[model samples]
Target chain A: MNKIEVKGLYKAYSDKGRRINGYDECRLPEGSTVLHDINLSIKRRSFTCFVGPSGCGKSTLLRIMAGFEHPTKGWVFIDGMPVNGPSPRHIFVFQEDGLLPWMTTRENVALGVRDIKDSDERRRRIIEYIELVGLKGFEDHYPHELSGGMRRRAEVARALITNPDILFMDEPFGALDFLTRLQMREEMINVHMMFDTTILFITHDIDEAIQLGDQIVILSERPTNLRADIPLAFPHPRDFTKGGLAALRRDIYFQMGIHTAL
Target chain B: MGEDGGERKNGFMKGALSKCRQADRILPALTVVVIIALWEWVVRIFSISPGVLPPPSRVAAALWGLAKSGVLFDYTVASLFRVTWGYFLAVAAAVPIGMFLGLWPLGRAVFNPIIQFLRPISPLAWIPLAILWLGIGDKPAVFLIFLAVFFPMLVCVMGSVAGIKVTYFRIAQNFGLTGYRLYTKVVLPAALPEIVVGLRITLGTAWLVIVAAEMIAVKSGLGYLIVDARNSLRMDRVIGGMVVIGIIGLALDRIIRRLETLPSVRWKRMQR
Candidate 1:
């Protein structure tokens, strides 16, 4: 069964009137379409990557599915129920620093599960997740005190500790330096393997898409629609240097209108 | 082997931290001693009139006299009481209202302009109105101090609340937090560092206004002590009063600084 389904989703922003020739003009708000007719379903316990150029509305589509945004047309369903608003069942990791600065690592990870009445159980799970994210000794450190990669790990732990059925990340590793990015990617795969939670990750990096995704959804430029949905049946820890992945990479670049050297 | 090395590292870190803390205290005390010595030298070298600029020794004598008479303690208590009540009251009243204004656009639109207009008109200007409205006593003085703190606290807290990154709210929502939980858990903590900064600045202004307010509106505070000493031509007492005010202001500011450094809010000053 599909974990999430998006059907004919559309989103648009209305630009407020701007001054022309130094005169205050009352122009009608004109809609600039961001996503057009976005349709796809993410399979259960799958890692799906939405790859596209910058400003291609992949994040918008992710937000709409996460229920942080509303689609101008069409619908999203989580387990056959239409998504009306944000639910704890789905956690969305923002691209920016989402960890509350005032909260320590333990507090940030524990915040989502605060509703749990059992204090001992809550503390135990918070510790477990902190250890899972490799933030064992830094539980008392605030987000600002943590390095970029550690902050991202804390954010991911915060999301996962909730044990949501699906997690949506919007270019989560985009801000990290190269070595840290590689380390975090390894940690992320370990986490996915452990939790087995379905994930929908959005990124512009084609290499990242191939490295992490079991299924890659390619998106077109502005007024974005799905250009392709390619599924990989390869096992975990696949070698990127293999002939098959190289061919796949060339195909994706071709789909994105880039001619690869291969 | 690694465990032993880690233990040795921890011991070294503790020793270094203690040494640094000692330096922090000693440096400030040394600066004070140096300043007093310079003042005593300058006064003697210039042969300045005692009425114009009394030596530090004379101010110390005057301070000792006040302490022996118990008048210094009384005046300190009076000023401290006014400042404490005024500061707490403004915080209590303004924080909730600021949150409301920050969250709700209509409320901000309606009241912001009025607050902006009132904020710039020095709270000293309210002395006449505070006296007329509340009558002579600690009440009028307290009112002026409250007025002095209220607007700045309100403006800063409102800005802090409004300035919260939208992404945090989305994260809060994603966690199923709404209404009060959303605010107390996410919004409040996120905005707290900025709010503490606002509180810290307004505290200095409150201390400043209390002295001025006490001089005119009340008859028994540090401000009154200074004014009374001036009228009696006791320059030593006047300088002593000034010294007491400076010390109290510095102490209050240090207290706020300590609060800002608490583990909960210290993220505002990330070393990086």
Candidate 2:
């Protein structure tokens, strides 16, 4: 059964004329459509990766599904109930610098299970989640003190500790260096395998999508529409150097207007 | 031989760095000494009247006299007392009001223009009205200092809260944090560093206003000491009062600056 469903999702930012403050200057112009007719459904516990061109609004789609943003025209259903606003049942792992800088890793991860009535249980789970993300010794370190990958891991742990039914990640590893990104991808797969949650990840990297996603969804540029949805039936440790994975990679490159042969 | 060269280079760099650190400590003291020496030299060389400009030695003697009499202690305490009452009261009121205005756009839209209008008007300009409304002594002086601190602090806290990254709020919302939890968990911590900076700047303004306010509204602070000395043709005592004000201002600034180094707000330094 589909754990999450987005039907005829559309988003547009209406410019409210001249804004007095500098904060509103970056917003899209009046009636600028970002996401148009985005329809998607994800099976329970599936790992889905959304890949698109820059500014194609894949993040918008994810945010809408996560209920951080509202769709201008259609409905998003999570387990057949409409999403009115962000809920603890679904958590978002921001692309960069989401963990509050003022908080240490332990304090930040503790925010996830703050509602738990038992103090001992909460403390144990905080420790458990921190260790799960491989941030054991760095629990007392602030976000600014941690390396980029470690901060990302801490954020992931914070999200996972809540035991949400769905996790939305918006390019969570995009800021990490090449080596850290590879290590995080491996850890992410382990996390997916161990957790029962449905994961919807947004990334611009096609190769990353091919490696991490159980199903890959491609999106087109502004006024974004679903271009393709391809299911990967193959097993883990996907090598894009040869076989069906490589063929798919080539196909995605072609779809995105890139010539891998060149 | 190569290792010896590397060790010698490291030693040389370390020595240079220590010398730089020493200079940081010594330079300001050196400048103060040089300026005082120049002032004394000019006064002595020109044979100027002491009333026109007293030498540092005479100023020091006047300070010694005030200390011996205990009036200096009393005046300093009076000024600090007023500043404490006014500044803390402003902080208590402005922070919450600023947070509310920052969180709600409608409140900000209505109040911001009025605040901006009042902020530009000098606190000294309120002396007449403050005297009329609150009457003499600490009340009027404290009121002026409060006026001096409040508007700037409100604007500062508003900016700080408003400047909090939208991502933090989204994270808080995603975790089901709302209302009071949102403020305590996300808003307060995120805005704290900037708020501390605002507090420091506004404390300086409060100190500045207290002196001027005391000159008119009260008669027991450093401002009054300076005015009384001038009336009695005691230029040395006036200079003594000015020096005391400068020292206390520096002390107050140093005290507030310590808040910036706290573990929670220390991320502000790293951001730079």
Candidate 3:
């Protein structure tokens, strides 16, 4: 089943009446479009990665899907209902650090599950998620006090504690060190298996897309449109150093028109 | 004999260490003493009239006289009371209004011009109007202090709220926080460091205004003591009042600086 559907999505940045051309009408300013004619359907409980070059509006599309932004023209339907605004049923993990500096790890996570009325239940869930992210002892630490990877884990814990139907992660591990990034990818896969939630992950890294995505949607340069779609059906614990993975990486690079040096 | 010898050695070492510690304080004390002695010498050598410029000794004598008569106590209490009430009232009013203006563009557009216009006009400038409107006494003095404090506080709080990273708001929104919950849980805490700074600054402003306000609009305060002593040709008492004001201002700033060390509101720069 399709969890989300987008049709004819167009977004442009413009001010009203700035480009008025006629007595009867005003046209949208030219050269302002970010995403044009975007159509996508994301399947339920599947991980989909949107891969694109920098400034290709992949993040904007994710934001539109998560209701952080509105498309200039089109409809985004979640469960056949048009998304009006950000909902608690969907969570967005930003690329940059978004953890509130003033809040402790426990408070940040608890902020996610604010709808939980019972105090005891909220505390239990907060602790469970904090431990799930391996931040058990650091619950009382603020974001500034934590390491980069720990802060990211705390943010992921904050998102997962709410148990959203779909999680939109826009290069959430992009700021971590190489080793931490690899560890986080594995952590994410473990989390996906445990939660079975729909994930729309955006990234510029082709390897990350292949590693985490069940289906990868490639995006073109701005004004961005869907370029190609690839499906990966490799089983869990698949190694990138293996045979099939190397070919897949080459294919993705070919599609992106990048020739890597041997 | 061994234990006694060790105890004596320990005591001697402790005394030496304490004396070394006290040496740190003695430098500033020595500077103050030298300055006072120089001031006394200059006055004597110049044959300066007592009415024109009182020496340090006469200022001390006058301060002692005021303390003995309970005049200094009365004036200090009066000034402290006015500052406390006026400054707190300004904070109580400014914070919420500032938050509202900071968050809402329309509200800011409506009131920002008026605030900017009033901000530059010193609170001392408002004394005559305050007296005209509120009548003579603590009311006018308090009113002037409040006016002095309100604008800077409002600007600081508003700017603080405006300066919060957009990421924080997005995080709060993503978690389904709305309205008052959004403010109490996210906005207020995030803006607290700046708000504290604003409060500290406005406390200084309030203190400054109280002296000026009391000089014109009230019967009793440090400012009144200065003005009254000057009129009576008692330069020593006037100098004593000025010294009291300086000491009080220094203490107030130090107290606020100490508040910056609190864990919950500790600024990044101020944190050890």
Candidate 4:
């Protein structure tokens, strides 16, 4: 069975004025049709990258796949069970350091595994992930105290500590600088190798889509449908500066509606 | 971690000291000092009636006199207890109900109209009804205070939940949290900041209501003390009571301010 399956999804958000009666709807108040007629399947343990233009519904599709959002008209299945809400066994990391502002780096990393009942094992795993992200001696620091790169690293530690079967990341490195972005990419590749979790990542950067994806899915404009599903052959720690990777970057540029700006 | 993070938790105090030395920060405080100085001079220069417009010094003297008698302390404690009981009761009832109303559309729709219709009615207006229901003493005063505090704070909490960043909610849901976990994990923490703000404002309003109610409802609190002094024409005690109320209100507000200190501010020099 595919680790994740999206079958003929249709979702629309109706944004209307606030009610005098003070009811809050889960859907957006401003009508936005984010996803329309999306059908796809992600094989187990594959590194899949979702690339598209702004507001093309890549993020929305990722949310639906993880069951954070419900489709207005379709069904999603993960591991043969219908996707109803968040699957605890699946982990998601987003662009912002979703680290609780109050929690120390350690507490945030330890969040998922803390309830495991075995204190020592949980602590050891938390420390291991923290150290894996190359954040040593900074476990006590809060999100605001860390630099942007460091905060993202802490997020990485938090996500990976859970040992999830599927990892969903939305624009994870889109906020970092060039040098830091490269470093984060390398760390992600290493973490993927270590855990072998099926990762579905969304990114606007074509180079990022090229460097990390085993198969890159390019989405069309919104109410979005598929444009292309191209596979990247380059293995992890793929050097973007290398000529082979650079060529793939050129192809993704055309796909994103930006014609080889580089 | 910087040494200052550990040693200088007194950011406001340190700021004041630094400003005093730099002269820029202290400038604002200095202006207030100057205004007080000028006001003191003017009142004394004009020889205003000790009753009608007592000088700052006379108010200070009256404060000292009350401190010595310890009767001022007694009145102060009564006021504090009344406000505290009412404020806590309002919060205990309002927070969870507000959370429920904010989370579910049905509850909000059902309760919201009722809340809105009643919101316009002042707590003072409810005094007579409160007296009738709870019978003319402490209960009426407490009920009035509760009415004044509960609705505004419940609205603030609803606003806080409404304003929660979409990403925060999404992240929590992605972890399979629903039911009680959803409330304890995502909604509560995200709404904390705005809820604290509501609690602070409610406490201030509660203080006012308690004092006002005590003057008529109950007999021994600061509000009654003020009325008794006024009727007896002991203006010094009245001024003392007013000052005591102001100081207590200021102290309560400062406590809330500390509690509501921003997440970033409390985090490793995130504010400074």
Candidate 5:
């Protein structure tokens, strides 16, 4: 079953001088198009990775799907209903600095389950989610006090505690150190395995897309259109140094205008 | 053998650290003492008349006299009462209006020019009008202090709210928080650190205005004490009043600063 469907999606910015709020990274000139006729279908519980070039509007696309911004013209349907604005059932984990710096880890995680009427049940779930993200002993620490990776974990816990049907992550580990990014990727996979929620992740790193994606959607440079949609059925601990994964990696590099032979 | 050496080194470092902290406390006191001594010596060397520039001893004596007569306490309480009322009133009004303006661009556009225009005009300019409208006593002084505090605090609160990271709003929206819930749960807490800073700054402005306000509009505050003392040719009492004002200003600043140390808002300091 398809969890989300994007039909004839197109986005453009009419304001030339002023930068758009929330999409500060992608500054377009007057009437310049971004995503051009983007169409995608994300299956339920499948981890889809969006890989694109810099300023290719991948984040814009993700934000549009999450209803943070409206497309110039198109429709995004989640569970057969059109998305009007951001909904509680769909959570977005921003690339960085998403955790409220003023809030403790416990308080931030509790944000998702704030509607739970039962106090004991809410406390239990908040603690459970905190432990699930391996932030047991540091519940009282603010976002600034936690390490970068720990802050990311807290954000993920906050998102997951709501049990959203679709989790939109925009380059969640882009700011982490190499070792922390690798560790987070493993933890991310563990999270996917443990939860039944569908995940839509955006990244510019090809290796990250190859490693974490169940289906990889490649996007082209400005006025971005869907370049390729490749579904990887490879099992866990799949080696990318050799075999089909390596060849596929080379193919992606070539398609992205990067020569691996160099 | 190495363990004992490490312990000795640790003890040395601890002792050095304590000594450094002690220096931090003592240096300010030492400077105050030196300045007072210099002031006294200059007064004695110049043989300055008491009416022109009283020595520290005479100023201290005058302060002791006020303290004994209990007028100092009364003056201090009056000034504090006006400041407290004016500052709280400004805070109560400015925070809500600031939030509204900060959140609503159209409203901000409508009102920002008026605020900016009024902001540059000194609060002293309002003295005649305050006196005319409210008459004498604490009312006019409080009104002037309110005028002094309200504009800057409004601007500060608005800036603080506007400065909140867009990501936090996105998170709030994603969680379906809207309207009052959004303000109470997300906006208030997120803008608190900056608001507390704003409160501290505006309180300083309020304290400054109160003295000037009291000099013209009221009869019981420290400002009145200084002016009334000058009328009687008591330079010592005037200086003493100034000293008391300085001390109370420092105390108010210290109290507001403690709010910044709260765990919820402490991230501002950490970020710095």
Candidate 6:
């Protein structure tokens, strides 16, 4: 069953009788337009990735899905209800950790759970998630003491502790080292597997798009209409060093406008 | 110790010891000792009158006399109370006002010009008006202190709030914070350091303004004591009161600086 659905999606910003970023000019001749009459459904517990370059409005779409920004003329339904704003049930992990400097790792992970009924239950879940993120001994440490990679781990751990039906990650591993990025992708996939969550991950990396996405949605330059949604034939626990993964990487690279070294 | 280990350890210790000495040790304090020595020598050489300029020893004697009389404590406590009450009033009023101004464009538009216009007027200038409006005693004294402290504090809170990085806001927004929760939980805490800095500035301002207020508006503070001693021709008591005021001001600023460096706030600073 589709856990998340988008239909006839349109997002435009207007102020002082001027359209935001000249998006009105990008609309085609038909009823369809840029971000053009989008229709797509995300399956339950599927790892979906959106790939596009900078200024492709990928982040804007992600923000809309997260309910930070409202769609101008379309609808996004979460669990069969239209999204008004970010609900507690749908957790989001941003590219930057955004961990409160005032909070400890344990507290940062447990911040959104203030509305949770049971304290003991929340504490146990927070601890479990913290341990899952490999930050067991550092639970009491603040965000300042953390390295960049550890801060991101804390963010992911915090987002997961809420036990959302869908985890929205906007370029979560975009700022990490290449090796750390690979490790983070595997960790995130493992997390999804362990928790059985639906993920809507957005990034510009084709290698990353191929690696973790079960459904890779490619977006055009701006007024980002859905370019392609390719399903990964590569199974879980896919080996990066293996030749099969390299070919998949090549296909996505050529498709996304990068030339081969040869 | 092993051959290389001993040398490395010795070098490390030397570096650590020197840093501590430079940062904290008593060499800097030697400047104070030298100044006092020079002052004493100059006074003795000039044969300065005890009535006109009491030597440090005579002033110290006056401090001892005042301590024994229990009069010094009463004046110090009274002055402390006025400063405390007035400083808190300024903070309580200014912080929310500053936050409103900082957070909302409309609030900034309304209040910014008024505050800027009033802020330039010195706390000392308000003395006569404060006495006339509040009419003597604690009211006038507290009013002057408030006048001195309010602007610095308001600016500090506004500046601190303004100083928050745009990244932090975007990050918080991404995590689903909006409305009041965003201001209280995110913006306030993020801007806390600047608010602290303002509080320190106002603490000193309160101390200063109270001295002026006490002298002209009220009659029982360190400033008044100095005035009374001048009339009585007890130069030693006047010098003693001045010393007490200086010491308290220095101490309060140090305490404030210490509070600002508390571990959590320091950690927050490092993150920024």
Candidate 5 fraction of reference contacts recovered: 0.75
- Measured against the true structure, the TM-scores of the candidates, in listed sequence, are 0.89, 0.94, 0.90, 0.86, 0.95, 0.86
Report candidate 2's fraction of native contacts.
Answer: 0.69
Candidate 6 chain A worst ten-residue window by lDDT: A17-26
Better of 2 and 6 by lDDT: 2
TM-score of model 2, chain A? Answer: 0.95
Model 6 Cα lDDT, one tens digit per residue, A154-202: 9888778777778888888888998889889889878877887899998
In CAPRI terms, model 3 is classed as incorrect
**Per-residue lDDT of model 6, residues B1-272, tens digit only:** 27699799989999999989886757668887888788778889999999888888889999999989998999999999999999999999989888877766567778888889999999888877877788979998888888888887887888677657654565566456678888877788778877887888889888987887778887898988988998999999998999999999999999889878865566566866
TM-score of chain B of 2: 0.92
* Cα deviation of A111, candidate 6, in Å: 1.6
What are the runs in model 6 whose C-alpha is more than 4 Å off? Answer: A8-40, A239-245, B1-23, B48-53, B162-184, B232-235
**Chain A TM-score by candidate, in order:** 0.92, 0.95, 0.91, 0.90, 0.96, 0.86
In candidate 6 the C-alpha lDDT for residue A84 amounts to 81
User: Each candidate's interface RMSD, rounded to one decimal?
Assistant: 8.2, 2.8, 10.1, 5.9, 2.0, 6.9
Q: Against the true structure, whose DockQ is highest? A: 5
Pick by TM-score: which candidate is best? 5
Sorted by lDDT (best first), the order is: 5, 2, 1, 3, 6, 4
- Of candidate 2 chain B, the 10-residue stretch with the lowest lDDT total is B263-272
**Regions of model 2 farther than 4 Å from truth:** A17-27, A259-262, B1-19
Candidate 1, backbone clash total: 0
List the pairs of residues colliding in candidate 4.
Answer: A15-A29, A15-A30, A15-A31
Over the stretch B152-177, how does candidate 2's per-residue lDDT look in tens digits? 99998899888778788888988878
Q: Write down the DockQ of candidate 5.
A: 0.64
